[model samples]
Target chain A: MREDKKTPSVRKLRVRKSHIKTRLVLFLLLTAALMLTVIFAQQICPYDPNAQDTSISLQPPSLEHLAGTDRFGRDMFSRILVGLQTSVLSTLCLVVIITVAGTAAGILCGYYGGILDSVVMRISDVCLAFPGLVFALAIASLLGGGLHNAVFALAVISWPKYARIARSQTLSVKNTDYISAARLAGGNSIQIIIRHVLPNSIGPILVTSMLDIGTMLMELAGLSFLGLGAQPPTAELGNMMSGGRSMLQTYPWVIIGPGIAIFAAVVIFNLLGDTFRDYLDPRNSRRN
Target chain B: MEPILTADNLTKIFDEKGKEKFTAVDHISFQLYPGETLGIVGESGSGKSTLAKMISRLTDITEGNLFLCGKEITRVKGKALRRAYEDIQMVFQSPAASFDPRRTLGDGIGESLRNHGVSKVNVQKEAVRLLKECGLSPEFADRYPHEVSGGQCQRAAIARALAIRPKILICDEATSALDVTVQQQIMELLGRMREEREIACIFICHNLGLVQSFCDRLLVMYEGKIVEEGTPDEVIKNPRSDYTKELIEAVL
Candidate 1:
């Protein structure tokens, strides 16, 4: 009877393990494919993304132009490929900046809390208090219309969320017995923070950053859509959508193509992030 | 013989500037000579763990002096404080929580050796040897804290604490979380280690019965103050203070 009960449990464990493995592998492959396309955007484009061909202007999807042609007669497919490169790369840069800076500030504050911690935490509160997009809009306009400025604006508003996550995570991990043990083992503050505190606290921070990818992508696009980002001739998804908005009804393909790209990018990253969270979640892994 | 560790009127006040200040360890003093096992028994919130923490320098000493082999370490900071740790080590109540969940048992055991400039290869060899000395299998060195049983993890924690060969070992309710059988096993292991190495120990636990056999001397604390001190048999058989009498009655 015990063997009968144990056999199913052992099989269940194997099944759960493989289920986690397969989903993780699938999403990882999809993310890799998306990154490769973005990296080789320029080389892979059949037609120059910025070049105009007036004779083919407003043409719908055809064998020659996969996503139809815009009013400027630029191939929508080629523009989208290049636009993805810009959007994805900028979002990646923004995520890296905030994750590194916010994590550093948080770990220091949480580990060695003093006047500096209170001051930085309050500043982050102020940043978080503002509506994210509106603040980004205000900063983007103040800094002038460009992709870099929009990213900078978004970065300023986005970092506080990461800081808050990292801070809370650090606070929880700080009091764990291992931290006390590390101190007893002759680890200095910096050594303790790097070895004991960071490793233990990093799980939530990484998941938050992964989930932020899609939100950052959308926010970046939102800024560009408002004319405060990626000025004309720069193939950015949001700018392309803005450029083709007026012709939404007459030549809907131009607007619809980039909209779909944005949607696909957002969905892909969000799902990947979700899967990554599931994979890293200890509760789920430990169940089997 | 000169005491290996000494605490002189050590006090710890939480939120000293706040209106509602709380004294965790108040004007406490004790001494641990080499090869001695000093057990501190107190009820919950009696500041037994706080006393351990202050002695090990994990918590800052709000006032008074702490000496290790005649060296004052009360105001030591930074690298000096870290260097002071070479003579003192601690094992906490929850053994599983005392090892980094991300690191293997070997890494946690060898961490001090690595920090003290031991070569990577030697640290690994020493860690494995320590694990063996602590009665854990060699394969257990590669396991994470969560992967091992509580008794096994506690043994690993003991191994890590002994890695640097510190003069003093502080076990703050180290076996309180384990089952009765496992607790006895750990106590035996601790006794064997102490006898083999002559490392002075400050064993903090609330269980009067458990410490009676293991400790040479016992200090009964009440509300952060030492209420009574004697050898385990003397205190348990003939308590002096009212609180110690009450404690002994409750246990009996």
Candidate 2:
């Protein structure tokens, strides 16, 4: 083999090592901190987030009561932290469900494009026509207000986008010579679909999945703000924001605490997803 | 002698939305005997690739029958269809795309064997042995497709096809992607392997010069039909069909 003429230079690999180092550190640090806030909610917080005391109700940011206390005298700091945990867990569950459903739909339609593809795509198109938040709200209100119903309704509306992305990616890769090679090598349909088709189609699916996380967090927060998510007195971030809205000027810290949590969650996930897409991009990898 | 591979009245029609349609491969027939190299030479859209795809069962035949190593394989499915690969194997023009980029070259070479019930421990050893036989260093197996030259990748692809010990090997423009020198090297390698194993080969290419030197017999195709057939020397020396005459004249 002509090593000097054709081999991909090893210098690029060296550059890639440093690139991964910073990305791994930042992604892990943010995710770990978020996980810790959820896992050690009570141990770290000095007061019960739900235990309201009307005596010290109208307070602002201070050492004795971080993020101040609401009109109900609930500690906004503890509520926001705990609310971050709830959003993350519920979103994780929804992502898992949506990924499974969407990836399966995409692969099946993509690999076996015919009447099955037409039917599946038609269904996905119908689902996608409904605006995401409005559809989730309609379903949540129909299912009755609860965090779980909100998550489920959101999942129902969200999977089609992933499915559409996955389907298009799969269709593009389906007829490639490598896939034909896989088939001629005695790989059965299922094995070829799972091993060859899915792996090749995963890049777009992953990028979209990351982007969807940010969108879902926003949708979940909005649902709760509309009083359809985690019920009152539970200290959910969106619910706290909703509760603090009416008394915005009187106790600004109450809205500010949970507001920052929601903003941070969306920004952190979106940035991580952007970094991940850039990392996985083949053109960028080639440069490295 | 019984033919190793036979195609009778093969055809492929492409339908566009059930309204506008055209026949890609018209009725064509051929037979390949063990130890024979049959060259299919045609211009683009002459259905050479489509014909090869039908023989390998990569695409369904619209109307025809294929008998590979004494088994009818026109409509087989599941395990039987998979087992048909034992008798018929194919090498593609673009060797880079023939391999899964996610896997090491060795893993790709050994994949067919693994499907054939070869043990995991034996696969690596078998793959290395196959690579060496194809005039490559065993270490080449560990390298990814991107790390190797086009010539090297074609060699590895040949090694993969040869690993299965198929009775009939179909190479569809297998060396067209390489340089003159590399193409000669691969042709020589295939010549050696054919002599050693007595495997029937269906060589599809647009290069009339290479076909004349390498293949024993020739089938000239035009619009999916075999317009002429004979020994490559006869076909080149005394061209019969007008199309064949034009093809030979263009190359010479």
Candidate 3:
């Protein structure tokens, strides 16, 4: 009787585990595909992304150019491939910077929580109070237009979100018995934070960063659209789209190509982030 | 003979500057001699846990002097504080909660040994051995805290505390979260360890019956003060304080 009752639950658990595994595998494969495309983008492009040809300017999609030619006569398909490489890679770089910097600052602040914490958190509060894109625009304009400056500006604004998540997670984990046990086990502050605090608090931060990928991508593209990011001949998706904006009615292929690339990238990352959140949640992961 | 641990008028005020200042533990003092099980019992919110926290140095002592092995450790910080932990260890109320959810039970058990300079290879072996010693299977070392039953996790917690070979072990309601049968088993294990190692222990709990059987000396606390103190038999038989009588009556 007991075996009969337990068998269904065991089966349910197995089903759930497989479901999570498949989702995780799909997400990883898609992310890897994006990364690989970014890595081999230059090699894969049929024509130089920045090369100009007045003879083929404003040409429609055809056998020669898959995404047609922009007003500047740059092959839309080639520009998009390289442009994807730039946009995705830079977004990844920006995410890494903000996640690392924010998590570090937050852990230190949440753990120690005195003068340094107060100062740093207040600064983050100020950063968070403003509209994110507007603040980034202000900083980007101040720093002058470039891919690096745009990333820096976005990073300056976006990091607080991760910091807030990390700080709150840290604060909640700080008082748990495991942390106290680590302390009683003779672990120094650094050891305790690394072993006990960071691992426990990292779930929410990771989820936040995963979800932020889509947002960051859109924001980066937005900056480029506003003429505050990735300059001419850079082959960034946003820049490509921005350059083709004037010719959108006349040569819709140019704008649509980069638009589709951005849309696909955003959707993939958002779905990956959703799956990551589901997998990371302990309620769903309790194998016992 | 000197005491293994001493708390001189330990106090803990929750808020420093506020309209409402609450004293969780108020002017409490006690001493634990070597090779003795000192039981601290009180009703809920009587500051038994707070007193335990102060003695273990997990929570800051608002106003008091804590002397471990006759050295004043009222305000020690950093390296010195970590050094102090080698001599003093704690098993908290919830066994599962005390072990890091992300880490294996073996990792939590071996953590102290690793932190105190034990080699990586030896730490694993020692952790398995400790698990076995605590009445758990060697395989339990690899399991996460939530994977095991509460009793098994408490046994792992006990193993972790004993790993450091500390002179003083503070059990802050360590077995309160377990079932009666499991509690009895844990009590028996603790009794055997006390005889074998002669490790001084501060066992904090609210269960009067358990304290009577397990403790060598009992301190009955009420409103953060040690209202009564004696051998468990003496206190239960001839209670000096009204709170002690009330506690005994409540148990009956």
Which ranking of candidates, highest lDDT first?
1, 3, 2
Model 1 reaches an interface RMSD of: 0.8
Highest TM-score: which candidate?
A: 3
Error of 2 at B50 (Å): 0.3
Q: After superposition, how far is residue B122 of candidate 3 from its true place, in Å?
A: 0.9
What tens digits encode model 3's per-residue C-alpha lDDT throughout B1-252?
A: 999888999999999665598888889888889999999999999999988888878889999899999998888988888888888888888988998999999999999899989999999999999999999999998899889999999999989999988899888998899999999999888888778889999999998998898899999999888889999999999999998899899889
DockQ of 2: 0.68
Top candidate when judged by DockQ against the true structure: 3
- Give me the displacement of residue A90 in model 1, in angstroms: 1.1
Task: Compute DockQ for each candidate against the true complex.
Answer: 0.80, 0.68, 0.82
Q: Is the docking of candidate 3 incorrect, acceptable, medium or high quality?
A: high
Question: Ten residues in a row with the worst lDDT in model 1 chain A?
Answer: A279-288
| Residue B209 local lDDT, model 1 | 88
Q: Higher-lDDT candidate among 2 and 3?
A: 3
Tens digit of per-residue lDDT, candidate 1, span A90-130: 99999999999899889888877889899999999988889
* lDDT, candidate 3, A1-288, per-residue tens: 999999999789778877987998998899889888889999998999889889889899998998888887888888899999999999999999999999999999999999989999999999999998999999999999999999999999988878888889999999999999988888888999998889888888888899999999999999998999999878898978887888778778988999999999999999999988888776666655
Off by over 4 Å in 3: A1-20, A282-288, B16-19
Question: Alpha carbon lDDT of residue B156, candidate 3?
Answer: 93
